[model samples]
Target: MDVDTDIDKHFQQLQDQKRMLLMAKSRKGEVPRDRKPPQVAYHQFMMSHMFRAGLAQSNENMIRSAFVPPAYQPCTTPIMKLQPIKINQLQLETHHRGRYIVLKVMTPPMRMTGILALGADANGDIVLLHMYNQEEENVREATDIVDVGMIVLVKEPYYKLTASKDYALRVDHLSDMVRLNEDDTMIPPQWMSRISEIHDSFEPHKAKADASMKKEKWWKAIRDYTAAIELGPPPDRLEIIKRNRALAYLKTKQYDAALADTGWPGFGPQPAEKALFRAAEALYHLRRFSESVAVLETLHATFPDNAQATFNLERAQKRHTEEETGCYDFKALQREAEHICPPHLDHATYIGPIKMKETAYKGRGLFVTKRVKAGDLLLCEKAFALAYVPERDEERSAGNGDITLLINIETEKGFMGGQADLIRIIAQKMYLNPSVAPAFTSLYHGDYGATPITFVDGNPVVDTFLIERTMALNVFGCPNSSLATHKRAMNNESMVDNVYHSCGIWPQASLINHSCTCSARRSFIGDMMVVRATRDLEPGDEVTFWYQIPHFKANMRDKLKGWGFVCDCALCQDAKQTKATVKKERTKLRAALTEKCNSPVPSHKAMERLIDKLEATYAVSPDLVPRLGHWDAQMQVARIYAAKGNMDQAFKSACKVLVFLGFSLDDSKKGFEIKKWGMVLDYLIDAFMFIGSALIELKALASAKKAYQYAKTVYRIVVGEDETFEKTYEDHVF
Candidate 1:
């Protein structure tokens, strides 16, 4: 006995610990670290056990029962089946010191459970039931048990009922008692007084109320019913009386009262589905789309496949989108402008946050009422919104020929003419790569400028969406007419420019005015373009980034010229003289290198000499060689040589020009370099995999397995999951 006691105590301690662990996990705050691992394992083990036991299956009947009234149907599933028995009268008892209504009932042999329940037998003996604890092994043997023909008693308490589902029941404990033997001898003075007062009231008043209700004078009839309820017992017919009263209340537009009466104890306690729908409808009527969405979202979470909830949710979400883009309040704009723009145009000031105002037509790009900085991210649009046309088969077949390129150009111009200028704007700044060229190559004619168009009043309205890309230039003041343009312009300059551009950023460019000798410059980085103050200007001074620079490399100058505006900018004015002088110097360097290559020096000695001269010239003017054509051509040749293991030539070629091509070293070979590196990485990843597979094919299991592991590590890094290197360390090392 002592040993058994000790064992039971140990088991109880383990069980208590497990319960504590479960409680900790279910708590709102973080669990203690020492407890977490064990809890996780326990939870996973339990889940697996339950899954194997088929315990995870949905209890469809329980779910239905939650929404349905109990009296409306039998216990929904076999799990809740009640045993049937027969009885008659019930005795009710409670220790609570309050006035309560006793409902007499016969306790049947069936198992009845509920704190407050209305139970009925086939013989029409309706009982207000509660749990009765009889202290005997068998109910038949218990002296307190109510046998057949004995009435069970129950108490009804008064409380104001509300609309929510949770408050439907009136019970303090699950095990409150009821007995089938009616104790009429124990009727209290309050019960007798209630019965006496009810019986003493006017029957004519009730007849009059019933007549008014039949005539559809609902409000008055309800008033009469209230008086009658106090005068006598509630109409003996539960369903018919309740339904008639509910209809009368509804006819009087007393929805609250109708809902209340319907949700009373004897009636179905509110139609949950209809209540949810009504809530959604009310929220929509109030123009509270987010609230409507929230209600529908809650419904969907509880009932995911509910068609009405899904439909309402979609409607609300769509309304939200429309509201954001359909209407532009100019008053709101004026107020924001006053807040964001500086008081004086003379001083650099904070132009407030500018976002798109609603446009009248499709393809209307970003619009801002307040001033914006040069490098600010006006908006980051997904590609789908941008206007584009598919590349034609003929264009694709042109195999990089001029005619195919020309066809691409025509298609782009046609779309722009039809009011989609996104392609044209992009083409002005980006030199089309082979990958994107087919789609947008012909979009920009030599004369086309970078402007977004919106259709207003049946006419095309062009607006400047971003600051024009600018390179080397001195700043100057802008025309007053062009103030809006200058405020939102993005100066397109490479990283090497004193400006900074990050794709998703915009800074002081919002404040800067256009100038040939601007004190500030901006640069682009992916989606961010940043304008850093290169030179300070006095208050009210217009900030400007140079629209053009003369001494910039060949492709840079060409791109600016393509904007079709004359080079009245300072850079263009001086670049002609600068270019001639640079050309003469470059010619002299080339002659020296060629003569050295032809001379009878040892091959290694000659190569060393060439390296020194090239490095010096490249350091002095890296753009010299690549100025004659596209910079990418030179870089591509270098990459090809690198791939073939001609490391000397590849390194020399890349070093000669690619390094100094852009403002920041990071930006110099960005777009093209990403593509180039991607190719090389792909090859290396494949090679590792191939080597592993080859070993496996040859049945060299040990080597094959090791190679496979190494290959996986390489793949992981390529996919940007470098931490995986440590995960498979053993496989690679072995």
Candidate 2:
């Protein structure tokens, strides 16, 4: 018969034998004396017949010849026949002079973040290979090219010698290693014959022994099962082995790998019921609750009487609904302020209302394409990477040797400079997520020239100087608010003191230029920074925010030193032309206002004089006097009126305080929710309470109740469900 006809006949005979054995077992009411199943026996019988016929030299070769087409081989080059030395022969005495070696992998590749892997050859010789290149594109390509149990040809291999004298072959370039498939014609016949013997004799016995010892020695069981699977066991046995490996993977917290073993296509037949249940459990641990629920639903449909499947299905469904609605407590991220804030608050990152553009004077600036009003959210940014600056006392008192040693090592490696710890953290983040490297490289690195170097794959290096300079010009120092500070206390003692500052890079927000008279003010709610318009802005307006405190006594020169720029903004330019006059006037006005504010019982006339002095000083140069002082002056006037029992004047003054702090009387005009206010929240809440008390004294009961309710809402947002403030306000109003 022709080859095709003969193969079909062989398969038909095996099927017939399997059917007869299964029938005999059913009649006898147990597996006939031998413990082997019909499917396993049939596979072994077919393999033995092929070996005796000599149509192919080994069972693996025979199976490949029957299934794989000659024209569809993985590699089609005659150069593959250039015989390579075995991995066992790769020693420093003979092969260290850059000789090539060919190896068939025996164990699963141990990958370290997709950059490097430790692989074992057929003879159990381990070698280290670097899998990434200098460019991020090349690094991603290398990760996709390598896998476990593939035959590979390495060229010009070198040894990396260590203190213990244990050496490994290193392959650096993508061209140095070539992956080969089992069906390739250039495979050496002797190696194939030995592999077949090892598979039949050693692998089956090893699998049985490992399965027996699985309960007490699960880690070893997983290793042995992986080896057996790589050796090409019989089809029925392969399914059983994969299921066993999946269970061990789940126990070890390797959820992704466990899911792959149970559900990956072409590994073997469909996994049995037990394996499917294990896959659902794996998905649940990975926090993919929706997928876990779906898998459990399928299991319940197939086996309606399964009590465990029903219980798990209900649990997964409930968790999936909670995750979709953001109802969980977020317990894992309580200490991390950046993670405590929900991503949905940052609309500018996900929503497109503004774009960055290049300017002649400013390197880059953010411009608004849509019209925005006062109290509108112009931008909300989440940090790309963040690191906390430890308090001076905490650093000196730290007891962990590993942390101290790491700092010393970094200093020796030349990462020590201004903000070196922050630079190191950002560099490590870029290395771990290569896709973000391109955006990071595009950021403006201050006036320093490029420092390029040759690439080494295994020991990848980042430019620390460039990272430090970029961060110096761009990072925002965010203060932890009272709300975030209280939440952070649930996780660690290090963050209990709210005085520590956390620094981070908001890549898009960095484009906004500095302005003393900024149109927008920035506030932090956890790690989320919300930028709202302090005044109405038209389309095409350059969106700007304050880089430093606007009311500080320092001149523009001192404030702009770290930024490496001159004072060119309208306020700075005005101050520059009349520096002496502006400085003298600001000092006089501030001194007068401070004295009046500190009085035990200030008169209404003195408060009115303070407001007039602030208005006149603002007229000279608005930037010289910050807007925060104006709000403080208005609050003082309101307190003076309330103290004198002048309810009408107190209500008007409180309303002005709210407006100056970026609150709108018309609720429809406000862009941001009241809960998003940062440091100003406490002041805003107090102003509302004052307004409510004044209206009550005036006998406007309905208006008074509305104002009190708004105050309660803001208080609830800041302190969560604790109702101490709400109860006190209600009792006072009643």
Candidate 3:
């Protein structure tokens, strides 16, 4: 949770300037309530920290990362006494331990992003409490977050001095606070006031909601319906109103709210046909396809001729099977991504042969359950929550692509704009489906440690800041892929892309560790993360993917510092052992080779000599260590030789591309055979493609066909599935 002191100083200067402006306004007898400050894109990750002091001067920080406080932990003593803790009696710089204090909000939150409220305890003693690392409160979007008149419990409240040099009780963690229903027994007699007029207006509110529904104002109808329900209507009327609200919730795409009203287990069972149908629809949208199928089956059986049920049942069955197996329609996935704002899709998640287990100093990682070959499916997982911002040519410069921002008030760092939206969406999802919280919280959040979710008033308490930290570490930058755009989009990032149009949290895939010479390769089909093995592996072999493929000149450790781990992969180890003299020699040879290849009068002999010099810098043979930089040089020389119609040298240089990558080959009369598989990369497919072309030029059709077969195996592994391999890669001959 360390922050930049400079950012903190900048925040203080901004605060002083704000006070001066407010004072000048007061002098003019025109004071503004809730005055805001200007925020610029600086010191908010991209390097600088967000700092401890408030920089949230504008309304932009509002309405993000709002979440429910955790459930109250009851005292375990056999005889517990109820005593009111006086907030006024609390002293600054003191941690008041061993007391559960009840309090009621007395004012609207004065600050946002990180919220603060002036409240009175059960003893009627008023004090200020600031919720650190939180979002806006009392917003209509998520009313359960916090609002005036809401009762809460503060555990062992720390009465401390904040950065503002003001006294307030600081609630740093969600575990330290618990929201309670107004009817809780601990609520003081003075705080037990309810409006009789509002309570009796249920009928009128329901009528207004019906009118709104007719006008197609779904959100308005939802608000009216919520107001009506909270007013305490009779059971029969309440059920009718809830059902109406459930439809509105569905229209608004609030599946969790719809499910809650669809007679979920906690709510009394409705058992009616429409209720069952609505419940199934909610489950369907939530991607609990198996549950959806079960519900739809029951409805279809009783309502035999229901066409909607029949159609949905078929779809649910297909989706459920897709989740169970890794089969998916990749073409359809691309089609969906083409839309600017696509619907929440069930590309169907399938966890294949991999199992998550703890590793040595690596912490946790995914491992293969059985011996598997390259092209074998490891996992095909849909994102838990995906935020995709279509590239708008007018908004951001082209190639910078889209960005997602997530700000952590605790750590005081900002991630990106899209990330902020994603964090809010995830918080709301967890709020709706409590079961999902455990899976989300289980992901790595570096040294932030773990905090379990607790339910309050039947609603799961989700920590928003924990989500910020977890996502900052685990979120993957997903770039859209299309067969139309690039035949082998998997290989098109020069085997590594730093730019992405979207990002998402894929829970199962996040468990895999990083390696430069990783065991598996990942490709995106819309929001679906498809992983396949890069090389053959034994049972219990760890599956790893490149977080970012390191370049020869790049400082790998510095680049991946945010990820909080140094890669100890074979390639990284080899790079470390490589001497400075070798690197200098490789650089000099690469320049000469590039000059020879790109010259108006290109010299084939000079390029070949320089390529040989580059390849020789490697301490070990190509069979043991990867000559990564040499392969590109060899490919360049091979291309020139092929154009000159010198098939002999083209074939040799083409074959050397595979050799430099640690693969041994045999082209005896027995035909083209890969004697051993070493480090595998998508570029090897290109190498074989070059080899195939060279063979065809040499009139060895049989050998060319054999080379193509090798290319197809590499293609399957690179693409992550064989379903569309032949169609996508119709021609593999260079």
Would you list the C-alpha lDDT of every candidate in the order shown? 0.33, 0.53, 0.66
Predicted structure with the largest TM-score when compared to the true one:
3
- After TM-score superposition, the amount by which residue 19's alpha carbon in candidate 2 deviates from its true location, in angstroms, is 86
Candidate 3: list runs displaced more than 4 Å.
1-196, 200-270, 340-344, 392-413, 445-453, 482-497, 667-670, 678-685, 709-734
Query: Tens digits of per-residue lDDT for model 1 on 456-545?
Result: 222222211111122101112111111122222313222222221101112223223233434344432111222333322333334344
Which residue runs of candidate 2 sit more than 4 Å off their true CA positions?
A: 1-361, 364-383, 388-424, 436-466, 480-499, 511-513, 516-543, 565-574, 577-579, 620-631, 655-682, 699-734
lDDT of 3 by residue, 1-734 (tens): 01111234235444554454344334332222221111221112112222312333321322223222222232221112434566655655555556667778755554433566666676555666777544333233323344577788776676654444345667755555766544456667666666233435788789988998998877678877888888898888888888889898887667888888878643455376777788888888888899999989888988988899899899989889888987777657656755535334566798888898899978899999998887678898888987664433343443233233333333545445456556666776676566566677878546654444365444456666567668777888765543322463445534223455456788998898887767888877667778888778888999998787656666677767777888887667777887888778878877777777789867767877877778767767877667766677678778889989898888877777778777788754236677777666756667777788888888888888888877777766665445565666666534
Ranking by TM-score: 3, 2, 1
Candidate 1: regions farther than 4 A off: 1-305, 308-379, 383-386, 395-558, 561-577, 584-658, 662-734
Predict model 1's lDDT versus the native.
0.33
- lDDT ranking from best to worst? 3, 2, 1
Q: Model 3 misses residue 5 by how many Å?
A: 19
Query: lDDT per residue, candidate 2, 1-734, as tens digits?
Result: 00001123244534444454344334432212322343453344345445444632332211101110001101112343344555545543122333456665433333222234445444554555443222222222333345555566665554333112234454433334555544344455545665443333436645554664545455456656766776788877777777877887776556766787786432235447877788898877665678888888878988889899999898888667554543323222223444543221211132225678887787888887888654556664556666444333454235211111011111122111113334545665554333455566677655566334312322223454456557657777655433444334423445433333355677877888877666666655455555665556678788777676444355766866667776576556655665577658767776787787788866667867766775665544332323455677778889888988887888878876665554545322112123212223435556767887887788777777667766655544343222345443444552
**Whose lDDT is greatest here?**
3
TM per prediction: 0.24, 0.49, 0.73
- Candidate 2 has a TM-score of 0.49
